[model samples]
Target: MLQGVAVWAQTDPGPQRIARFEAVEGSIQFQSAADNQTRLADPRWPLAAGDRVWAAAGSRGELNAGGAIVRVGDGADITFTALDERNAQIRLTAGTLGVVLRDIPPGDRFEIDTPNLAVVLDRPGRWRLDVDPQRNTTRVTAEQGSGTLYGEGGQPLAFNAPQSREYAFRSLAGSQPLALNSGDAFDRWSNERDRALAQSPSLRYASADIPGVAQLDAYGDWGNDPRYGAIWYPRSVAADWAPYRNGHWEFIPPWGWTWVDDAPWGFAPFHYGRWEQAGNRWGWIPGPPQRRQPYAPALPFGGARPNIPQGVPPGFRPPMQHPMAPQRIGAPIEPLADQVRRDQWERTQRAQQDQHQADMQRQQQMREAQQRFQPSYGQRQLDEQRRQIEQQQQQQMFQQRHQQEQLMRQDQQQQMQRMAEQQARQRQIQQDQMQRQPMQPAMQPQMPQRMQPQAQPQVQPQAAPQAPMMRQGGVQNRGGGEPGGRGSHGGPPPNH
Candidate 1:
């Protein structure tokens, strides 16, 4: 063992070896230049110019010139052709690698050119390049500092600002820039973080600390702590589906059972769509979050969000602002109550109007049916019914007219009787007034002096023409003259 620590090397179609090796803190392994021999180490090793390396489980190493680090993960192969105190250039034979620099030396720039993309790192920052051999697409992420990416003809793409992401060299010959996602961020961070952890090697925490451990510690887990970024939840099946190792997770539509991982396109759904429960199964639909979906009385048909059991809490839901949160089922939707009430009222009114229209339509249909059948064998029965209905209508009209006429006659007779009785009462009041006094005193004011003149001839004016003789019973007595008691013919008649 070298330095009392186990050291191993294999050169079977792998990177060439370098002589005069030095190990640093069991973290960084370094070797001096050896002519025509390739030297490689685990991701924990450091590399320099003129060194060729191959990554078995995606190893990332550093270059001493300005402490710049480059990582290659999972079946990747890279070679440094011009690495030195001033020059940094590498070639990627296959797979993905990310480049980050501790400091960029003045007049010392690094260039990475692939079949589809070319990146020139002029500043200190983190950047990634992914080459899909079959698809021929190059994905890039520039986390900090700015860089210029080029197409085949050095056509410039402005890749400035931190976290500015893009994908180049697509399957199609002429393609637009593609944006980066959280999953890509996760992958990039994961790789670099892993490289850092491998370099240092002694840190631990708990499951809660797993996220923190991944955040804080650069070294890998020493005590096999679950909290060291070494866990993944199944998302579909909660029954402990953590990857004891590293892999990928893919979303399949219709039945969103996340059944596949460890592939190029598998991680896209979680990064670009929504998760929902449909048909009692989980699924992912592609869209933005629906912040105003109505609260459905029942879940939507087909792929719908199934209710989680009380005992099982689903994974934490992402905020609406986050782009990757699923839209259909997991979308953060909240409809206003007024909007809901308005919709319900509109539906109710529509139903009511429809029912009324239907009743009218049914009546029309029945009439049409009767008319249509009248020309057939059922004509006799229909005619009989129609005749009976006509007769009943005629009878009802006649009764109404008769009642109106009777009411009019009774009202006229009562009016006549009232007029006669009123006239009789007026005549009786006049008779009573006449019997009380006569107007003779007003006609003779000098009569009182004549009566007092004693011895004077007792002359009296004739009594007022007897008022029209009062009639008795049904007839009036004829002969009733004044003072002489004689009728105009000079003969007295019966005076009852």
Candidate 2:
């Protein structure tokens, strides 16, 4: 009992962190980090240290913080002892929880303490913890990777896919191993879920390193916009769907209003980038994933908050059912800083905002310069177009001249034939008149005038006609139109 107090005293809480509520189902209630009151659980609820979540009968809950996913089964209670970037500590008082640590950096910690012993996962793996305080026993089954069960005397029993008994910490001098767990329906379900997420086409376009991208793939499909690069649209949402809707506003200590979304895949999109209206729908612009994310949505706009169930009432505190039980059942239980201080999240946030504003200014300047350059571009296009029209007119003139010359030649030929026919007829008539009657007035006969025609000039059409390139926005070049690509994710919330 004195040990708890000593550990709590020596510990220095550095900063606050957020764990993701990946999924929530059935009857479950969790205490909020912002308001310290037990409220109903939602998929996108952000949990932190000092929070506790209880799962009622036939209930299930899942918390995903970075690479670790801790799932609570029915009739279970878990407390967050230390939930931060470097360590993730939880105490399972009763019931069972399935844990899957996808990745854990070296020197990082993930521990699940039970009444009998403390289970520490030193590597990436899947494990299950079941505690029975009535029997004063705990059992840890390592399904994959490696872990260790530390006794009260500081003895470590290595686990490489083994099932082990949870003995009383100081009493058990030796530890034994058992068979590797074959997994259950939940394990199969997880495998299928991951496989589906891996195959998501959005994964290819987006940075796989982004934590909440898999959720995006599940909720939306990838599409490309001519103005923006690759984007994604939610499958089922209001036509005027906007981010920060269907959520509540809770005041994060030292930080202003923080939005908690109810959707399962809400964290990354809200914390990292900006939102652009891509026609009828909205798309999140994650920017370059190779940078730090902010605390609030990178870009905040004023919008109405969604109507949601109110948090736990004021002055509401859970009953203390078991006073002797530890929040975490582990050796040398480390304490978390309960005091609120300057938040590091908001610090990064301000820096990111400054950078974002600078970038916007630069972009505006570029756009202004482009606009100034457009007049000359349009002038050049107009000159080239006029030249094309003049050439076409010249070609038409030459073709018309040639056609007229050809028609004149044909008319002259027809006239000459008619003249010859008339002359022949006249000669024949004169002979007939002389034969029929006495010859008279021979002096009057004179030579007929010779027919003549005028000459004309011929012309040829222009051989080649060229057209210049006509661009709408001057020399601006854009991404090539491609059909398939994984969409990018992340962005700030819309107006409240």
Query: Which one wins on lDDT?
Result: 2
Q: Each candidate's TM vs. the true structure?
A: 0.31, 0.50
lDDT of 2 by residue, 343-445 (tens): 3455678899999999999999999998877667688899999999999999999999999999999999999999998678658755743454333365655
* Candidate 2 TM-score to native: 0.50
User: Residue 411's C-alpha lDDT in candidate 2?
Assistant: 100
RMSD per prediction, one decimal? 24.9, 35.5
Stretches of candidate 1 exceeding 4 Å from the true structure: 1-34, 38-46, 57-65, 162-496
What pairs collide in candidate 2?
205-486, 273-491, 273-492, 302-495, 302-496, 303-495, 303-496, 304-496
lDDT of 1 at 172: 23
Q: For candidate 1, write residues 346-441 as lDDT tens digits.
A: 779999999999999999999999887767658778988999999999999999999999999999999999999868965985586457434545
Badly placed stretches (over 4 Å) of model 2 are: 1-16, 162-164, 168-179, 182-212, 223-230, 235-248, 252-255, 260-267, 276-281, 287-496
